[model samples]
Target: MFLAILASNIRLVSHWSESRGVYDDICYLRQAHLFQRFGWHGLDTSLAHETDGYLAGKLRSIDFPNWNEPTRAPCHTEIADGSKWVMTPPPGTGFVLALFPEGFQVIPLYALANVMIGGFALYGLWRAREAGSLTLAALFGALSITFMINPAKASYSMAPTMVVCALAGLVTARLFVDEGRRRLMMIAAVGILLGLSASFRIANVILSAGYFLFFGLSFLIWRTRETFVAGLTLGLAFLVGLLPVFAANLVNSGHPLVSAYGGQDTAAPHLDPAVLRAYLRDTQFPLMVIACAWTALLWRFANHAGVRQLTLLVGANLALNLAFFATHPVFTPYYIIPILMLSLWTLLFAAVFTRGPVQGFDRAPPGRPRPPEMLSRV
Candidate 1:
C-alpha cells in the first residue's frame, strides 16, 4: 500500500509538472544539482548567495543559455518581497530537493519522500493502537494516508515537515496516555522532531509552543516527577534541534528569529488594516469555522485520551492561525501546517471511534465484558 501510494504521488507530481510548466522545479533541480556537486561549499554558487554579476559569470562559464536578458532574482527573494512574485518553492521543498542526485527534478522526489514519511506515520499509529481494535487501527491508518497524501498547493512542500511532526505527535500521545516506561525518551524525541520541523519552517514554532503548553499542563495536573523530567528533556532536545536554524538565521539576518527571506510586515506594504480585516472576514473565518466544527465532532466521539490530545491539537492550530492573521502581514498555506496535522488526528480519532461501536468488531474473545465500547470514552 505504501509503495503504491508513493508511485501514485510520483505520477501525480509528474503530471502536474508537465501541465504547469511555470512551476519552480528548475530552481529546485538546480539547487539539488549544486548540492550534489559541492556539498556545503556549493552554497556560495547558488543564486541566493551570488550577486547578479557572479551569477551571470557562472552561467557564462557553464555555457548555459541566457535568453538575452538579466536573470531574475532567486525565488526566495520573490517570496520575501511579496510583490508580483507571490508563490515560490517553500523552504522545506528546497531541503528535499537538496537530497536528490544531480540532473534529477526534485518535485517527484519530494512527493515520493512524503509518501514514505506518511507511511512511517501510519506505522506509528498502528503500533500505538489498542489491542482490541487492530482492524480499526488499519482503517485509520489508510484514511490518514489518503487524507495526507495530497500534493496540490503547498502540501507537497510541507509534507516532509508535517510527517515528522505527525510522527512526533503520535508517539507523544502514546507515551503520555499509555504511561510507557520510555515516555521520557519519547517525549524528548518528539521535541527534537518538532524543532527540526520548525527549522525547516519557522512558522512551526507556534505549534511547538502549543505542544509545550499542553504537555506542561498535563504534567502539573498529573503531579509526577517523571512528567517534569520528560518536559525538561523535551525542552533540551528542542533547543539542540533548533541550533541549526538559529545559526543560519543569525548568520543571514542579524537576529536569531529573523528569516533570511525578510520580516513579515516588511513583505506586504500595501496590506492596509481594512484589507487585512476583509481577508480575515472572508477566507480565515470560514476555514476556522469548518475546522472547529469537524474537530469538535471528532473529539466528542473519540477515546478520552485521544479526545484530549486532539482537542489540544485543534485548539492550538486555530489559536495560532488567529494570532498570525492578526499580527503577520503575510500568510501562506504552509503556515497552516499545524492545522493540517491536527486535521489528520481528528479524522483518525473519528475513524477509531466510529469503528468501535460496530457489533462484529466489538465482540470479544469470550471473556472481557465487551471491551467497553470505545476504550475509556470521555
Candidate 2:
C-alpha cells in the first residue's frame, strides 16, 4: 500500500513543476529560496523581485510553451507598497518546500516521505484496533489510500493534506502509546508536529486550541500529575516549534500574527448564511453539522480517554473552520478537503477504540491492563 502510494505520488509530481499550470506551488518555491538565502527579513527584500520574475517569465511561460498566453494569468495581489506579493495562500506549504533543495527531485522526495509517514500512521491505526479485525483495518487503510491519490487533496505540494496526515499520526500515537514518560515524549512530538503543520497553514492553529482544550479536560477528568506534565510539555513544545513562523511573520509584516493576505478583505460579509450552507452542501463538507452528529454518535462507544478527547478535538476543529470560512468571501472545493480528510480519520479512530475488546487484542503484559486503561488512569 505504501509503495503504491509512493510510486503514484512520485509519478504525478515528476510531471508537474514550476512550468505547469499556474498554482500556489511556485510561490512556495520562491518563498523557500528566499528563506534559504536570507531568512524572513530576506522575504521582505525579495518578494517583489520574485513576483516580478514569476509574473513576467514563469507565469507567462504557461506550461513552458512557446507562445505566452496572457488571458490565463494568475491573479496575484501585492502589498507593502508593492514590495511584497501575497499568494493568498498559507505559508506553511512554502516552509515545507523550503526544507528541500529546489530541483525536480524535491517534489518526488517530499511525495515519497509523505507517503511513508501516512503509511506508518495508517499502520498504527490498524494495529491499535481493538476489534482485531484485519478486514476492517484493511478497509480503513484503503480509504486512506483512496484519499491520498486525489491530486487536489494530496498531489499538490500544499499544506492541507500534509497537515491531515500529521494530525492523524498524532491521534494514532495517542491511541496506541502507553502512559508513561514515553507517552509524555510522544505527546510532545505530537505537539511539535501540530505546530509544524500550522506553520504551513495558519488556520490549523485552531486544532491546537482543540488539543489544548482536550489536555485541560484530561487534567480535570483524570487529575494525574502525568497528564498535567504531558499537557504542559506538549504546549511548550508546540509554542517553541512555532517561534520560527512567528519570527518570519514579524520580520515580513511587522506583526507576528499578520500574514501576507491579512491586509485583504477577509471578514467582510460576501454571501448569505443560506448561500454558504448551500455551497457547503454542494462541496460535501457540512463539517459543523456532520461533526455534531458524529460526536454524539461516537462518544458513547469511545473506550479510551485519548479517543474520546480526539473525537471532541476533531469536532471542535471542524466547527472552528466552518465558522471561519463561512465568514470569508470566497469558497473553493479544495479548501474543505483537509477538513473532510480529518473527519474521516477521526471517524476511523472512533471505530478502532469503540470496537470493544477482542481476546488477543485486549491483552497487555501478563496481569497488566491495556494501554487504554492507563489512559483512563490519567
Candidate 3:
C-alpha cells in the first residue's frame, strides 16, 4: 500500500506544470528568481526590483493584463504608505523554489516532499510489523501520500508545511517516550521544525500555539525545572528557527514584526458563520471531523501519561486551529488542511511510537522501550 502510494505520487508529480497560471505560484516563483539573482538580498521583494523581464514574461504567459506594469504585479501588496509593493507571502517557499532552477521547481518540490513523507511511512511500517499495527500504518501511509496531490498541491507552501508537520509529528512522539537528554533534543527539534514552517506560510506560526500552551501550563502546574527547561528550550529554538521570516519582514515590510500581506490577508479575525459553513461544505470538513474524533478518542482513554499528554496537546491544537480558521472571514480548500494533517500525522505517529494509547488507537504488542516526552496543544 505504501509503495503504491509513492508510485502514484510520482506519477502525479511527473505531470505538474510549474507555471500553472496560479497567481500565488507566479509570486512565489518570482521570489525564487529574486533570490537566485540577488542571493540573500532577495529578501527585498519590492516590485521596483524587477529590472529584468522575468516577472513580466511570466505574467504574459498567464496573459495577465498588466503584465508590463510593475505596480500591477498579481500578488504584490503596496506598503501602507504606498512606497512600494512587495510579495505577500513569507519568503521560505520562495527560498526553497530558488534552490531549484526556474521553470523546473514545483514538480521537484512535490516529488521531494512525497519522498520524505514516504520515508517516514516506511519507518512507521517497519516499527509496527505486527498485524493490527501494520494495517493502521499502511492505511495512514496511503492517506498521507494521496493527500499530497489534492489539498497539499493547493499551495506551494503546503509542500514544505506538510514536510515539517510530518517531522514534527514523529519528533513529538519521541519527546514523550525518550528519557533525559534525548527528550530535550526532540523538544528542540520539534520547535525548530515548527518555527521554520512559518517561513513557508506565516499562518503556520499558529501551529506552535498548542505546544507553547502545553509547555506553559505544564510549567505552571508542576513548577519543575525540567518543564521549565523544556518550555524554554522549545521557545528559544523556535525563535531561532523563525529567523528567515524575521529577515524577510525586516527587508520587505520595513519592520521585522509587520506583515507583507494586504489588508484582506491580515485583517482582524472575527466570527464568520459563513466561513464555518464553507468549511462544512468542503471536502476538508470531513478530514476535520475525523481529526477531532481521533483526538477525542485518544484523550478520553489513553493510559500512558505521555500519550495522554500528547493527546491533550493534539486536542488543544485542533480546537485552537479550528477556531481560528472557522472564525476568520475567508475560506479555502486548503486552509484547514495543514492543521488537519498535523493532528492526524501526530496521532498516527503516536500510535506507532508510543506505548500508551488507550485500546483501539494502537495494539502494537510490546515494542522494545518506547521512545519518551508529553505536554498538549498544536
| Candidate 3 lDDT tens digits, 1-378 | 777878888898999887777888898898899999999999899888888889999999988888898778787878877788888898999999888878898889889999998898888887774466677788878888888888888899999988899888888877775556688888889899989989999889989999999999999999999999999999999998899988988888888878887433556889887887788899898888888888887777665678888988988888888888877777889887888888888887777765334433433358644323221110
Which digits, one per residue and each the tens of the lDDT, describe model 2 over residues 1-378? 645665666676566555556555555655566666666544442344453454446545555343243223342355556555445444556555666776553455456555654664566456564445355555545545544445344334443444455465446435442455477667777677667666666655655665677778878999999779878988998887677667666656667776656655555755567757656576345544655676666666666675666667677766766666676666655555555556655565556545645534534678775687555654
Q: Which scores higher on lDDT, 1 or 2?
A: 2
Q: How many residue pairs clash in each candidate?
A: 0, 2, 13
Give all TM-scores, in the order shown.
Answer: 0.66, 0.72, 0.90
For residues 1-378, could you state the per-residue lDDT of candidate 1 as single tens digits?
645665666666655542133224444444444545666543322244443353344344444455222335334343233322211232344456677654454455656655766665466455444554455456445544554444234543455665665666566555535556776777777777777776555666665766677668869989898768867898898887777566555544445665655632354334358646655655334545666765676567555665566566556756755566556666544455455554455444334443344334544566666556445441
Model 3: which ten-residue window has the lowest total lDDT?
369-378
Error of 1 at 53 (Å): 9.2
Q: In terms of TM-score, which candidate is stronger, 2 or 3? A: 3
**What is the clash count of model 1?**
0
Scored by lDDT, model 2 comes in at: 0.57
Query: Considering every candidate listed, which one attains the maximal TM-score?
Result: 3
Q: For candidate 1, what's the RMSD?
A: 7.2
Candidate ranking under TM-score, highest first, comes to: 3, 2, 1
